[model samples]
Structure formats: C-alpha cells, structure tokens
Target: MANDEAAIKSYLAKYKHRDFTTREVMSLIQVYRSLTYRLEVFVFNNGTRKNLLNLEGTIPVTYKGAVYNIPVCIWLMDTHPQNVPLCFVKPTADMTIRVSKYVDSNGKVYLPYLHEWNPNGSNLMKLVQSMIAAFGELPPVYSKPRNEMPMPYPPTFPTTFPHPQYPSQPGPTFMPHVRPTAEMPTYPNFGLPYPHPGTANGSQFPTPANPLPYPTFNYGSSPEVAGGTITEEHIKVSLLSAVEDKLRRRLNEQSQQSQAELETLRRTAQELQEGKMRLEDILARLQKERSDLDKNITILQEKEKELQSAVERLGEQEGVDVDEAVVTTAPLYTQLMNSFAEEATLEDAIYYMGEALRKEVIDLDTFLKQVRTLARRQFTLRALMQKCRQKAQLAC
Candidate 1:
C-alpha cells in the first residue's frame, strides 16, 4: 500500500494541479481495484507528445439485466481537473466497437458529461459513474464468437438488476467485455427491467404470459458429416485464429507505445541541444569579459609602477626647499623671484606688528609707523617685480 501510494505520488508529481488530482486519483483507485495507473506519453492530434498519467481498466456497466465490465483508458493531462481527460474504449480481440452517440468508430468516448465538464464539480469518480450510466444505456462494444457466424444476442430474462456502483465492491457480478451479438437492448435506467422494444406494448420484464423466445447453441453436441466430424480440426483452427488475433493486437499496441516513446526522446534531445547552445553563448560572453578585464589590469599595473617611481624620486629630494629648487631661466626672472620674495617677507613683518599692537606689546602709534615703513619698501619691491616679469615676457 505504501509503495502504491508512493508510485501514484511520483506519477502525479508533474501534474499542474497535483494536490486535488492526487486526491481524486487516490479515491478512484481505492474504489476500482481493476483500474491501474501509469505515467506514459500521450500524443496529441497536432503531433505533440507529453508524458501524462493514464488510468486504464474496466468500469462495470449494467446492460439489460446483466452487469458487464467495459474496458476503458482515461488519460489525464498535465492540466487535469482544469481540463477534461481524454477517454477511449479499449475493445479486445473478441470484441468490436459499437459505434453510437457515446462512442465513435475509433473507440473514442463522447458524452454530455465530458462536454460540459466543470473543474469545480466534475471529478474522476463522478466521471466514471456517468460512463457507467451512459454505457449501461448504450453499450459501446459487442463480442464476437470465435470461428462462428455472428448470432443475435440471447434475450436476457429480467432478474435482480445490478446498479452502477463501485467496481471493487462485490454487490454486482460483472462479466468481461464479451457479448454474443451485435444487436443489444438498451436500458431505460440503471437497475431497471429489460424492456423488449419489438413487443406490441413495450414489455418491461419477461413473464410466462409474455416470455422472450431466444435460441440456444449447444457446442458440446457434435454434428454428423458424411466424411468424419471435423470438430477437432475446426477447434484447432479456431484456437490458432484467436491466438493470432490476440498477438496482432498486442503487437500493434507495443508498436504505438514505442513510437510515442521515440517521439518523447526526440523532443528531449531537441531541448537539450537548445540549452547547450544558450550555455555556449553565455560562456563565450564571459570569456570575452575576462579578456577585457585582463587587459585593463595590465594597463593599471603599468600606471601604478610609473606613479611609484615618481614617489620614490620625490622622497629622495625631501631635504631640498621646493621654492629654491626652481632655477630662473634668465637674469630678469632671477631678479623677479628675489623681489617677489622680499615683498612677501615685508608683508609678513607688517602683519606681526599689527598682532603686537593688538596684544599691547607695542603701542598703536609704534605699530602704525613700522607698518607704514614696511609698506613703502614692499610697494617698491612689488613694482620692481612687475617690471622684471614684463621684461621676461611672463604673466604678472
């Protein structure tokens, strides 16, 4: 049970609506013991293949007054519950699909229940119930007798009719998808009496007064022929034919499954190729950026070496006065530098005399006289510096 639950979880992991889908599926599988779930690739009409969850098994349908199990496969899309599942009838070798309003020639089922499926209301259990009710009304397939001419179905006597209920529950005894004939009667409602339509008045049940006359075949009785009975040889040939038909059907199913898997592999390969191309593109861009960064680092390293060399040379000349280190280009420039120095010295002396006066170290009158004298000499030096600069063709 744990393994089954785990397997179901793994299969439904890819579903878009996993929570509700899992709940519905668990409920369905618990009720229908014959039904099994698998994750397989389902191909669309447009040639798109997707790995979807498939629940395949027989749903018990009450036909006439007897219960028959109808083989069906339900495919849930990735968007299941939100979207209606793809349903189909699977007829075996001994059965042929009966084309009707509910089922098509290809064994695809169609009904108002599926047509008007509501995500909020429609569920797998209810869907199966609807199928049971619908198929009970009009059976989708009829069985064929092996190696014999087709005969009309024997009229079933009305007895305890089986209701459409859970398949796992043992209230109704169900038969396989094998009916003897093509012409089958329809039930007005589930668990109702078998009504013969051909009767003068629609007879609901067979009675001694209105008994249904049906022919019975005795296979045990051998027919006498002029040349010996061919029953043994006929039986052998019939078994061979049945085996061949069963093998052919199995082979066809295997081939289709292989084809779908091949398509899925091809799609996966295509996606992987696309991903590789994108990754290659990103790698190339990263390499180019790395190359650019390397070149920039080399350039910055060269600039750092040049700056370090300049700093080292400056450190060696730390003892030299920066102003005196300037060598005048001509005699007039030399005189201009000297006069500018003297004028700056006089301005400093006058600033100190004003400070002394503020501190009362010198009288205001003494400070004024000293500042006036220094100012007169500073003014003369500044005029001489301007003249020397003009003579040297330098800005004043």
Candidate 2:
C-alpha cells in the first residue's frame, strides 16, 4: 500500500504543471477525487455545457496517498480565472456536474473565488493535479465583439404621376339613361255601375246578364226553340229519369254486398274442408290404435292363462290338492274374466263405449295440437310421427 501511494503521488506531481483549460481541470478533479475515495468515475459528454461525470462501482487504486469511499463533482466557473465549488458526495452510480456562471440577485455574472488546498487538511492539490492530467485544458472565456457604422435610410417619393401610357385616351362620360311615359295608371272600383254595360265609364258594351231564365210550361211553342216553357209530359219524363237513376244506384250497391258475402262463403268452405280432412285423419289413427290395443290385450290374456296353469301343475307336484290351488288362483281367473267381460247390456256397453271414444278423441286432439306446434317450429313430419307413436305406446 505504501508503494502504491508513492506511485500515485509521483503521477499527480507530474500533472501539477500541465496546461489545462478550466473545463478540463474541473472534469479531471472530479475523476481524481472519486478515484482517491476508491469510487469509479464515468465521464459522460452532455454535448452542451459541462461534460457529466458518473461515479460507478469502486476504484481499487489509491490516489495522492489517501483512500476514500465518497463520490463528488467539481464545477468550473465560466469567466476569468477558473475555480470550483465543493459539492455533496453522491451514493449513486451517476451524477450531473452542472456548470453555471455564478450570478447575483440582479442577474449579473460574478467570478468565483479560488480555493487553496491544504496538504495537512485534505491533500486536495494532488487530486486536482491528477484531474488536470486526466482532462486536457480549460475552455477560454467568451465575449461579444463591438459594432461600427450607422444604418442607411429609405428614399422618398412625390404623389403625382410622371408619365402616362396612352396620352390620347378619352375621359369617362356620365348621363341619365331612362325616360318616363305620359299614360296614366288605372285602379279597379269595388261596386258595379248601374245603367251601364260592364265598366263604370260610359262605354257601349254588354252588361252583367243572368245565366238562366225562368222555366215556362207552354208545350204549344216550337220544340227547337232556344228559350221555351215546360209541359206536363216533360215533367213526367224528368221524374221517371230521376227514379231510374236511384234504382240503378241501389242495384249497384246490392251487387257489391252480394259479392262480399260470396267471398266470405268461399273462405268458410275452405276452412270446413280442412276440418273434414283433419277429422278423417284422426279417425284413421284411432282405428289403428284400437287394433294395436286389442292385440296387446290378447297377448296379455294368453300369458296370464299360461301362468295359472303352471301354478296349478306346481301345486299338484308338491302334493297339494287341486281344488285348493284352484281356490287360491281364483283372483287371477277373475282378472282374466274382467278383461274379457263383453256380455254387458248394449245400453250400458254403448255408454261406456261412448266415454272411451270421447277419451280417445280428446287424446287425438291433444296429439294434433302438439303436432301443430311442432310443425310451426319447423320440425320434420317423419320425426314428429315417430315421437307420437312412441308416446302413444308408452301411454298405453
């Protein structure tokens, strides 16, 4: 560690006399100080003002014979002799080194005071020298150049034309173009003039004449006369003509009513035809169902009879009496009897048959209603028919 410190001191001494511009010195000081504290320096060129310096990771090498872990920035003044301000140590990897011209509250730029490094206090001289070695030279101060010469003035002009394009052209002419007439205007009067033709002025013209003359009843006058009297025969003829017109109107009205009634009757006939077709279909379906029921009843009766005979045979084989077995199977026999009971009186049987028929009709009506609903929903006829057959068998 002693050897490394001595080597850092020798390197810093070599850069102490180096010619460095103010900006370069400030950048090098930041890097040098950061390295002395064992903190890495990352130089970033912001492309404008002061170049930024970022402290990242750690600096393992010693600088100016001292070790530190804190990071800092060194800002340079813009004018005359360059100086720096002591900034707080940052714990982050990157920090901005702001270069600003110190200004008073009146907005005037002021030169910053130079700081002297104490060897016993902080040994900042060695770090500043090392910073000068790393960064080259400081930038020169800027100022505006002075201006000379006065501005030129524009020329003046008179308000009259100097020369004309067409010297012989005529001047503009002005005159009134319209002339008045001597005829007087006329206004219409509201009332008609008496003892005069059509106008209030005394002019010889036709007056306001009545459109129709009173009718006369003189048949003796000429038949081709322009204005003639009416006779009793003409009155009779006119009355007959009016009566004929009324009769024709009544006949036309009756004809229209009759045509409407005919149309209603046609619609009623169509509905009745459809109802008849539906009834025929229902009757056919009922007949088919009755046949199937009869077949099923016969099959069930045969099975029942076979079961009774088998029970009797089993009882006999077990040494039971035949009369006792018959008595025990009497209920089964009665059920079969009830199933085949066709000897009821015609009136009673007819009544029961009518009730059964009514029930079958009601079932058919319900089925038709279901079918219509399915049809309205666009279900296939074949599918509906299959479902209906399955449901009817299950009901049975």
Candidate 3:
C-alpha cells in the first residue's frame, strides 16, 4: 500500500507542472491574436467578450479545386488533457442548407481523428487541421437572396393640353385634373338654380347672387375645350358606359346570391321536417321497447317468488326418501361434474358459471335457460339421492 501511494504521488507531481503551462497558453494566445488579425475571426460567448485564444478562430480548407475559410471554435475544460478540447466548425446565419452529418445542431464537428488523439502525440494545431480536412467532404456556403425590383407609381387622370387661343402661364388657377365626365358625377345642391341651355348651368331660374363661387367655371387646359373635339366626347361616353356596366353586374350578382340563399333555406326547412318525422318514429320505437322491458321485469319477479318457494321445499326435503321417477334423471345431474377441470369439483364449476353470468359473459336469456335446466336436474338428483340404498357402495 505504501508503494502504491508513492507511485500515485509521483505521477501527480509529474503532471503538476501541467502540459498546457503558462508558456503554452501564452503561445496559443499569440497564435490566436495573429490569426484573428489576419482572418477577421471573432471570439465571444453569448454576446460576452472573451479571451480570443480559448474559443474562436478560423481554418483554411480545400475541396475540389477551391479553398474555403471555415470558422472554427475550441472549448477548453480545466481538466484539459484528461478531457480533450471540444472543437466545432461554426457556420454563420447565412448558411441556409441542411446540416451535414459531420456536424451537430450546435455546429460541433466530428471526425475519427479526434478519437485517435493522444495527449503526448496531438496538439491543438493538429486537431484543427483534422477538422478542416473532415469538413472538406461537405462545404458551407454564404449565400444571399436576390432582391426584387420595385413597382412603378399608380396611374392618374390624364393631363389635358391648354387651348391654343389661351397661352399657358406659371401656376395657372385650376384644380388637379378632374376625372372625365364619362363617369356619373355627383354634384352637390349648389343652393342656386341650374342654368338653362344657352345660359351658364341648365337652370331657367335667375343667376345666384354669389356669382357661382369664384372659379366654379374653371375648365381644363386641354385643346379639346367645350365641344370642339368630337373624339374626346366619344371616349368620355365609352368610360361612362363601362362604369354603368360594372354597377349593373354588381347588382345582378347580389340578386343571384340572394336567390341561392333562399333556395338553401327552403331545402333546409324540408330536411328539418323529415328529420322531425324520423325522430317521432324513433321515439315510438323506444316506447315499445320500454313496455316490453316492463313485461320482462314482471316475469323475472314472478320467477324470483317461485325460486323462494322451491328453496323452502328443498330445505324440508334435504334428507327425505325419493321414488323411481327421480332415479331415472339422476344420470343427467352426475354428467354436469364432467364439465369442470380434471382436479375441480361440481361446486367450482357452478361458482364460475354464476360469476360468468354476473359479468354478462352469457346473456340474460341464456343464463335463465341454463338455470331452469339445472334446477330440474338438481331436484331430480336430490330426490334420487334420498332414495339411494344406505348400503350401496360409494364411488370416487
């Protein structure tokens, strides 16, 4: 025991200096700083700044004819060489493809080289290289979706050209281009009478005292003024016709929908009447079944009374002598014992049969029929037993 203790202490002391000594951690840190400087790899844990040496870096790997820069990470446990650092290939958010089997959901990489690692033989450099090589089998891609083109502005009422007689001017007084009169226009009650044909508005009544609100007679700058252009008038008419057609179509659709709903309601009313009749029939059937059940209940009560009287008679005749009529039926009751298990008695069979009947394994009719048959046989057997010679040989 003393020798074993000495050996263990020496082994611990040997490892006490630590394989990853101050120099090694510092050297790893230097390597990481240089790599981060060159490759733009960052180090972090849950958004917390951390020592770059421990958990992050990048490795260059080659596949086919191209080379890739794979972001790599290392997790160092306090027990280090006793527990090797876990390495991972960390893909960024842009890597949209399905994860390959070589990597886990957490982005940790797996390779056979890791299993074969020896504390004396392998270092962080060699392990990372192995991961890079394993990753060459399937590579990650940084992809971005192409942007779609934007839509153009919506259409507006066409601008009309000014009449040649009236020269154009800066900011001429006019409302924004009004829709063509082809549409059915809603004019508010101007409170003044409409003008007559030769007059301003179409009303024969005298002009209003307000002079029809300033600029009310304002017109478009279009060369097709009052009635000089025939084509414009026809185009305006066509637009009015189109608007009227749309209004007619909507009204027709509403009427058709109303008709369809009325038809559905009519069918539903008929179905409900038929369903009411069917329910009435079902109710009548249930009433008939209830009456039949009441009759059956009265019959069962009568049988119960007869069973009580027979039980009283059986008690009185327990040891009485019987005659020849019962002797002829004795064999039937003896046959019942054969229906039981080899090691069982007639009492066990009867108990199990009663339990089965109670559990409804046999229906009420079948149970009642069996009981009537057994009762007659049992009574005959009892009578024959009473008549048996007390001197007869007993059977096993």
Candidate 4:
C-alpha cells in the first residue's frame, strides 16, 4: 500500500505539471482503464472537499503498486469480462459514463477513451471496462483532443499568488431586484367598468393624479446648446447684439480703410489736375509763339519782296545814266544847244537829247546809301523771326 501510494503521488505530480484540473484527471481515469492501471490523483484547496463528497461510500484500494479510491457497487456487474482487473477509481460530483466501440486491425472490439484515445491494437477496451467496474460510473466531464473538440472555456492563469480579499474598488454590496414601473394611465382602465355612485347623470369628476414638475434645463450663457432657463427670445436678442457688435467693428474698420483710400485718390487727382493745367499753359504758350513766328515770317517775306522790287528799280535808273555817259561825253551846256536845234528839226531828236542831259547830272553816292539801308532792314527782320521760332521750339 505504501509503494502504491508513492507511485500514485508520483503520477499525480506529473499530471500537475500538465496543468490538468482534478476534475479532468478523474474523468480520464473513469473513461480509460489503460490510464487507471497506473493512475494518480491529488486535491488541493476546495478540490479535495469536492472529491470527498463525490465518492462518499468508496474505499481506497491498491493495484499493481498504485492506489485507487473507487465505489464498490460497480464490481458486482455480471456482464463485465472476467480477465480484466478492476483498476481505476474516480471521484467527482456527477456519475454517468458515455462510451463508444471500434474494431482494431486485429479484429478485436475496443472501447475508445473520450474522443481522443486510440483503441486500435491497444487493450484500451479491457482497461476501460475495468475502470468502469471499479468506479461505478465515469465522471460526467471529459476532455477531448484539441483538433476534435471545442474548449469548454477560455484558458485562464492564476492572477495572484496570495489572493487579496477585497477588490480594487468598492462594488455594490446588495443590489435590489427592481420590477419595472407600470405604464401611464389609459382611458379604458380608468375604472370605466364601475358605475359612478355620486351623480345621477353618470358624470363624476375623477381625482387628478399629482402632475410631475416639468424639468428645467439651465444651459447657462454658453452658445452651444440652445435650451436654457433663459427664454429663447432673450438668447436670440443676445445673439443679435453680438452679431451687431461684430458687424459694427468690421464696418468701422472698412470705413476707415475706405476713407484713407479716398484721401489718397483725392490727392492723386489734385496732382493730375495741376499737371494737366500746366501742360495746357505750356501748350497755349507754344501755340502763341508758333503763331507769332508764322506771322513774322509772312511779314519778312513781304518786306524782302518789296526790297527786291526797289533794288531792281534802282538798277534800271543807274543803267540809264551809265549808258548816257558812254554815248555823250560832251559838257552839259553843249547838250542843251543840241536839244534846242533838234526841237526845230525832229521830235525823236528832242527826246534823246533830254534823256542824255538828265543821266549825266544824277548822284551815284545817294543811290548806294539807299540800297545799303534796305539790305540792313531785311537782315534785322530775318534775325527776329529766327529767334521767335527757337523760343517756340524750346517751349514745346
């Protein structure tokens, strides 16, 4: 018995490393006799108490060096095969076993363990039957292979080594289960089936239920939510005031900017006006100078024509005297006697005599002085006209 207990303890230690819970370990021993031959089980914390309650009347026994605690009633079944030894013991809350059979390649009937254990060519059926005989029934809970079944629950790990009694925050100690309130009053359910006792006309004033106070929302002066203790009209007035203030400030700024621009434009326009007037004055002065120059040119041309005509007349008079001097070289007194004798004889002889006498007596010095004075007048007039033209060009 000591050796069997040691072996069971050793196997249980191995199972502890595998992270199988006590319930899962017991289930395996119940379902598979192969595991029961060398099964080990242990309990810690609440698990030990739960196991004791499940196998209340069972006795602990030993097989092949391993100890098992199982119920005795399963051993009395006549249908169980004889060659297999009752080996396994299981402790659990519920006792009901499920089994399936399969034939091995050697044509032997075998019992499968859970959904995972391979019964083919392994004496699993005989082992499972022995476990059933010892345990009375398999544990109700079982584990299946990962590929073939869904997990019963999500995996978890120990959150604390030494668990704390109190949670981090205070939660509700007792929450009363509350029934929902009845709906609002309706017409048909308002005691309409009962006859009114007071009034003969069947009209009676119903007692009024107390009216609930209307909720008051105070949104303060924040512009976000529109509802408040303040009326909507007051809010609208405040909003309009704010908008008007903003608009007034913007308009003032715009007006100031516009006034500044207008002043600048006025100054610019004044400067342009002054410039235009100056240009007009200059244009008028140039035009007047041009007119004066044109008039002076016309007068100078007329004076030059007159001077040329006078010079031509003087040249003709001078040529008459020079021709007379070459034809009649005699004294003035002898030319007078030739004239009087020619008058008695011929008219042509008298005319030639008078012309010759007049030419021989004319003064050359006086004629030259008159020509020099006319040429000087022409030069002075031309110079005055040229000066006027240059002044006009400079103004332009």
**115-195 per-residue lDDT for model 2 (tens digits):** 243223433344443333222121111111113111221143211111111111122111111114421111111122111
lDDT against the true structure, per candidate, is 0.66, 0.34, 0.45, 0.35
User: Candidate 3 residues 1-396, lDDT tens each?
Assistant: 345334333433333334453334445544433222111122222232222223454454555534444555565433445445555544433232213444432344545656565666666666765776776766532322223122221244111211111011111121222335532221111122222122432223333343321111111232332333335654554455446544544665577679879999999999999999999999999999999999999999999999999999989874756433344445544443332222244345556678989898998788777767666665665455444433233342
Candidates 2 and 4: which is better by lDDT?
4
Error (Å) of candidate 2 at residue 363 is 63
TM-score of 4: 0.20
lDDT of 4 by residue, 1-396 (tens): 355345444544433222222333344345422222233122323333111111112232233222333322111011111111112222122221112122111111122232222223224234444444433332211222223322121144221111111111121111112225431111111112211212232223221243111111222454433321335754565456446544544675577679879999999999999999999999999999999999999999999999999999888874456435655334543444344344334444334445555586435565445445554654554455455445445321
TM-score of 1: 0.40
Task: Please list the Cα RMSD from the true structure of every candidate, rounded to 1 decimal place.
Answer: 17.7, 53.5, 34.3, 45.7
- How many clashes show up in model 1? 0
Candidate 1 overall lDDT versus native: 0.66
Off by over 4 Å in 1: 148-396
Best model per lDDT: 1
| Steric clash count of candidate 4 | 2
Query: Candidate 1's residue-wise lDDT over 1-396, tens digit each?
Result: 678778888888888898788888889988876677888765443345667898876666656565566677787778888777767776544455665567654466677788678888899999999998999877877654445443332355322111111112112222223335543222111222222323332322233333222211222353432232346744654456446545544675577679879999999999999999999999999999999999999999999999999999989875988687799877787888889889989988988888899899999888888888999999899889878878878786
Residue 152 lDDT (model 4): 27
* Ten-residue stretch with the least lDDT total in model 4: 159-168
